[model samples]
Target chain A: MASKTQSKTTAEFADDPINASLTADDKIELLRKMVRIRRFEQTSLKHYHAGSIGGFLHLYIGQESVAVGSISLLGDHDHVITAYRDHGHALAVGMTMDECMAEVFGKKTGCSKGKGGSMHYFAPDKNYWGGHGIVGGQTPLGAGLAFGVKYLGQKGCCLCYLGDGAINQGAFHEALNLAALWDLPVIFIIENNGYSMGTSQVRSSAHPEEGLAARAQGYNMDWAQIDGVSVYEIRAGVNKAVLRAHEESRPTLLEIKTYRHKGHSVADANAEKYRTKEEIQEHMAEHDPIDFWKSTLIGEGVITEDDYKQINKEAGAEADAAAEFAIKSPFPDESEIFDDIYWEVDNNTEAGRTGRHFFHG
Target chain B: MPREITYREALREGLDEELAHDDNVVIIGEEVAEYNGAYKVTEGLWKKWGDKRVIDAPISEAGFIGMGIGASMLGIRPVMELMFYSFAYVAFDQMMNNAATCRYMSGGLINVPIVVRGPANGGTNVGATHSHTPENIFANMPGLKVVSPSDPYDVKGLIKSSIRDNDPVYFMESTVLYGMAGEVPSNDELDEGELIVPIGKAKVKREGADISLIAHGRAVVSSLAAADILAEKYNINAEVLDLRSIRPLDEQAIMETVRKTHRAVYVEENKPFCGIGAQVSSMIMEQAFDDLDAPVLRITSADAPAFYSPPIEKLQLPTPEEIVERSLTIC
Candidate 1:
């Protein structure tokens, strides 16, 4: 259950340090989340490179902790929905690696029964609504899902994730205003990678840093801006926003200033012509979420170097197994094109019949 | 025990009976509360149910309409009113994106049970922007269910049925016929106030043998008038079918009637080229080609704007005289 008491503010996230006496187990779990996301994306990136997967693939490489920390705060009853750049969030929300990879490969064993591909993954059992594609398209849908939560009297909130590029779309504004006016239980998180495709935030948006959160003011919503790369800070920022949403039946906006390690998609070369090599290297060294967590865990004696190798080895094995399973998994029957277009029956959905349960609830 | 009531009142009673019985149902739109709706279909609902149930909205069609989609996605039955049928364009994003695509796009995870109502079809001098019928525009979409009820009975029964349907329904009422009175049973009867006419079912107003006169929306009434004139004066028996729903058209009914009559005349209030009549005609020609004794005739308004000028408006919409003339030519 979410705490009714208001937590610390967005600025407070940067100020509050992890207690110096923190347990190794706690730090291990945090580091595990970071590793899980990193390994998953790396595997997916490898698959995309090998020409095994087709269609648009958006990897959440550097921004793994944003989803891990925020989703960790949510209960089983809570829901999540985001844009095409959604593998990290889906994995963090507990969708199996096999199904996620299968979906990317457009196999029968995939989530959405291979119909959704990368941009339209839906894990309803886990309360993950979708993997939408059209820039800001998922905002209104997220608001609707939150509205569903209120309508059914569910004691949970929906985390609506979008990109910095998505903020400029009209649906975002319409959804935010309506969510606040109705006081729907939703937390809107804008993952500001400082670019909407090739265009930088400065060129695309007039006030990029705070503009996303400021738009919430028209709806009188609680707003925050945070250093998104810092795992502890992102965790605190999301936890505070989630608390307000659960208790007050209100929506909050959080602007997470993060950077993407990979280029926009597998297509971009990330050539130094558009942006300096120094900037890319600066982000890799200074703001790499996984590196920061690994160092912190090691420094605190959370786990030995052996434990780190063991976890990475397990992740690699898991990714390899997932790839093997997806490759071996028969292509979905051509007849399956007609299936799952409209959901039928309550307990026996297609995803369940396939022995892949995205959500327990 | 039927009595006279306007199309608007019938719709109101239909909504009232639906909301009274179903706890999950609610109505939201501009002026649906204090101002009693622009067409007054939701009169006195706000004072009775309060703002929570009969929501009064700001002039944010895209916002509230999207809210309705969100509400429906969550399990609430929301009936949204697009102030004028013309203003429905403002919220097309919600209708097309969230309402129509949720089930297919979500890979069958969500069902959006939403009803958007307004007056469609031309006439009453609302001018070019406000007065053109665009139900055909939506009728072309694969996922949506489009309906245009032409009478008080249909307005009542169809609205009740649309409320309970799982798919998103686009219910277009008429501007000119909202005040047209007709027989509607009292609320005392068990099924009187609440009538569920299944979507995509055509109602045969009058069965005849000479020619099949098919129409919908305001044209249904116009076709019926033409049928009456043909029966009384020329003694030509023309079967008139009121096509209540447009998307999943009651093709079986139309094909059966065309098989009997061997000639067809489709009347529409919209312009001639590529209108709903064209689609209906194509379907008939494709399926019932051997049954046709003559070329299928279509009585539609001229291919021009629905201007404010009376004569131009008169030329740009189908009337009873035009339907009769077209039917006689087909006969």
Candidate 2:
């Protein structure tokens, strides 16, 4: 089976050295990550329906390659942040599946200790800033993360991801201007999944025929658009932006075209109302990032059909075990509610002890 | 002897000391670098430390403030200056949601050691848009710490403490009181150490037993004036208390003052509805209800958006006359 040709927009940077440097095992690992993320989302959604997991579940089913490909290129100083559809990024950045599943389950053993629900996962140690919920809220934060990197004199960058809907937010524009003017080492990755919740990109955003990344032109920053379905293409394009950020302390706006098979969230039952079932099916069948990568690896002889099946089996088992762990984990104790609200209050410092930190106490 | 400095100078001194104290502390905001500052509270520091230390951001409050919050999570202490605290509404979501909840949401894995400081009083006659006193609003949030200093001494000390705090501190100042001079500990007198007025503490501006006049920010100045009037004209002694920190409120100090005076009057520039006074009034009633001689009365700004006209705006905020009258009723 032949892999699809690289999109013309990303053709200039298609031959990224980072892709060439990946060994057979590393390439197979990327496939495994994508598979794991897919299985995780599927399992989480199952529990969501079964009433074990509560709140909204923004499944990152079809967009696994975007997180796995881009995050695999990050170095020690590099950081990543994304909007609510963040399980892929969280898993890609080395968060345990158990912790990620438990976080969504709202259990005490969760990454955020059951404080942040599905929309807010954070691993500062991994340089994964958060799972921000607001549309364009993380844009400024992404730039700020880069600002911290520059201030500390570290040669690293921050990858800030947002959806097509967030493009229209004033905060994103302001962040772009600041990132450009200050020469902050940050990459604004627009995960263009066509629709902003229910509204399609065409209805929610305004852009030239050059596409949404062209808005970067207004900020006097470099921009590119890429086919997000291919992990090879995502790495090829994102690697250039990362290199530019490291070497020149510059910012780039890279719009990666992708799709979500599920609705905005499990709560967004009207996902089928705005777009047709046929469009979703077409994307799932033809352009599924996981399936596309799986065939590409097979064609390249990196992994045989049997190896792919083994990998899928392992990923499925891991995801199922994570769900079991989440279900068994107890909810946070009632007394623990007052904890973690303020660093001072939790640490029992003079500032914390001096005042009434909690009203109830 | 302590030297007298304007409130603006006191704030600038605090920022300068912190910048010199820590390599991680940086000042960021619109016109905060080259143009001195919107209120000149950050004056001369830009030239002293250079651009990297003192950054001049675009006039996007949400962008810069949120950026500051992001930077703080990574160990950089950002002292963000909002031109007017009123403009905080422009970045309300960022301030209220992101900065306030980052610690709790991340389950204490991340700490936002950022300070957002600016004028937040309504008497400048900058109209309703510019003259918002939102100390009560920001104080209402749990994760955030709110500080509004009245005099130069408290401003200098509290600014330092707020910067050093490991949480998001909203330092509300007064444009009208920026030039007002009060005695501050001079640099030469700091042979002992740096002056740091701890957050969540109240200070007694004047001591008395007849009645207690409690306030924060510029209202403390008005309360002091009313206290003088109470002593000279009414032959009644009034104790004046300044709540330097609003959120981690000095409940002990408030209860003590209420217990001492038996009659108390809450004075503030914040609007009457859901204002700081309302919270204090409730606390007083709950803790010291039996000790109270009269119902705790509140003297707040008129329950409306600040008036644009100078005279009307002056009347819109709590005046010494109103404080005195309100105190007389309680006393």
Shares of reference contacts reproduced by the candidates, in order, are 0.36, 0.79
Prediction RMSDs, each to the true structure = 5.9, 1.7
* Candidate 2 chain B superposition, TM-score: 0.98
In angstroms, give how far residue A144 of model 1 lies from its true place: 2.6
Segments in model 1 whose C-alpha atoms lie over 4 Å from true places: A1-27, A208-211, A268-273, A342-361, B187-194, B271-273
lDDT string, candidate 1, B133-162, tens digits: 778887766557788899998899889988
lDDT of 1: 0.79
Worst ten in a row by lDDT for model 1 chain A: A352-361
lDDT for each candidate structure: 0.79, 0.91
Per-residue lDDT tens digits for candidate 2, residues A323-358, read 999999999899878888889989999999876766
Clashing pairs in 1: A119-A131, A125-A359, A126-A359, A148-B74
Model 1, residue A174: C-alpha shift (Å): 1.7
